[model samples]
Target: MNPREHIPVLLEESLALLDIGRDGIYIDGTLGLAGHAEEILKRNPRARLVGIDLDDRSIRKAQARLQPFEDRVDLYHADFKCIPELDIDFPAVRGILLDLGMSSYQLDTADRGFGHSQEGPLDMRMDDRNKLTAAKILDKYPEPKLAQLFREYGELKQAAKLARKIASVRRTQKIESTTHLRGLVEEVCHWIPQRGKIHPAAKVFQALRIEVNQELQGLGEFLIEAIGLVGPGTRLAVISFHSLEDRIVKHTLARLSRPEYGDSVIDILTKHPVVPSEDEVARNPRSRSAKLRAAVKRPHGS
Candidate 1:
């Protein structure tokens, strides 16, 4: 599959909120396929981009897709949370973007072990460089800890029961593949009455991915650091697909944009989050869940 062709969700809404300036500098903290980065560059010839991602495949593909604008873009193989140390040459970045969803490539690759349907390794680390994998967590974590992970992160009502089943299954046979885990989850959840379109194992997989990547924890820190790095009039935009991530972005932006709590450094741009349009959702179902929040650095005394 051509990884470069992965469609970025809410593309128009994100770029619109960014309000790109011709000579400005920008950072795409979650540069998936450089879809948004490419558009940002096309909007302004003199604008420069610092694109970063934990996924090595994403970095390589983004580099190639953005190579036409070689002079204006720099790709990095790092997490957004570590943006403070990236080799940014620009004096003041005018815009920062965080698209916080796993890309189509990641979910579809199946070997990466993100999808519940695809039978592959139980590795869920966004950065393959990381040591921990889902299989390790399944095998090593105690029942209490696994239950806590499922309850808190997955919000599963039967967290304890599910954890017990996982522990029981792993003892008899190694839980080293996606299919193995999926079957285990299904066994425990087959009794749950269908009420909506969501799969029974969706939340479990989501929780594991978040835990594996330390996504929420890293996001909170990254937002604070990223907000402090931009200059006055700079814009920050975040697109979150899930409620957990959306909650973090929503609260962080609120605190930063507040005149009382904050240092009066930024102003909230999107009073309410901008969601994907109905047409966009129809075209791409994945875009349906996206919510975009934006804030701009306030001019001194404004």
Candidate 2:
């Protein structure tokens, strides 16, 4: 409901891998509401932070939340993909963190359209400057393309059936609201509420959100470039929510950890992803799906 209530998923696990005691900058690429950034500053007296997020609302809240550490922080209003272009002291960077999950604040805000549980329009744009929207995709995409999207992004079994359903509905009425589209998805998937079962509308909304924000497009490339930019021993931690994103992070880290030119660039800290414990998941249900993977750049010829 508020910034204070936002729990940074995999908080202690990420901080441990970061090894944040050194005197340098820590970059929170997906700052959200500065949940992790605040902790980093609070716990590591020597650490300064560079926090970046696409959501202006989150950034403003983060800025307010981080006011005490303003002198040690640099807040940016941009995408984490823009990390390579930012004016950062690469050599002095201690660690970098990217929590790829959508912030709770964004999901809680109805107008953002990140949550199917909430009734709102089909905006789904993390950055307001972005021209694409969930409604635009629904309105413009052909049935086949929509099917492909639902299948690939949402992994929905009834992709074609749902796409066909949307095609039928949009002819007479626009798919403008989150509730409107959610109801259609439920209808196509056959509405049934069962304990512990994820709603089909949640998958549909996730697929739309990914498409609207291009969430997966530049993620792997950014990780590779970022690892290449930082100095040896600089740590990187990523918390990805879905399998689509976790796959990218896993493969990218794997590739980087492999020896090339007689030297591996990074050492994968977690042979497998570090997931949240059942206790944390019980406390913050949104974090149940999170997977955290970390790596550190290796010194040359080692």
Choose the strongest candidate by TM-score: 2
Candidate 2 global lDDT = 0.91
What lDDT does model 1 reach? 0.84
Tell me the tens digit of each residue's lDDT in model 2 across 124-215.
99999999999999999999999999999999999999999999999999999989998999889998999989999888888999999999
The collision pairs in model 1 are none
Compute each candidate's TM-score over C-alphas: 0.94, 0.97
RMSD of each: 1.9, 1.3
Q: Which regions of candidate 2 fall more than 4 Å away from where they truly are?
A: 1-4, 261-264
Model 2, position 162: C-alpha lDDT score: 96
What C-alpha lDDT do the candidate models reach, one value each?
0.84, 0.91
Model 1 collision count: 0
Q: How close is candidate 2 to the true structure, as a TM-score?
A: 0.97
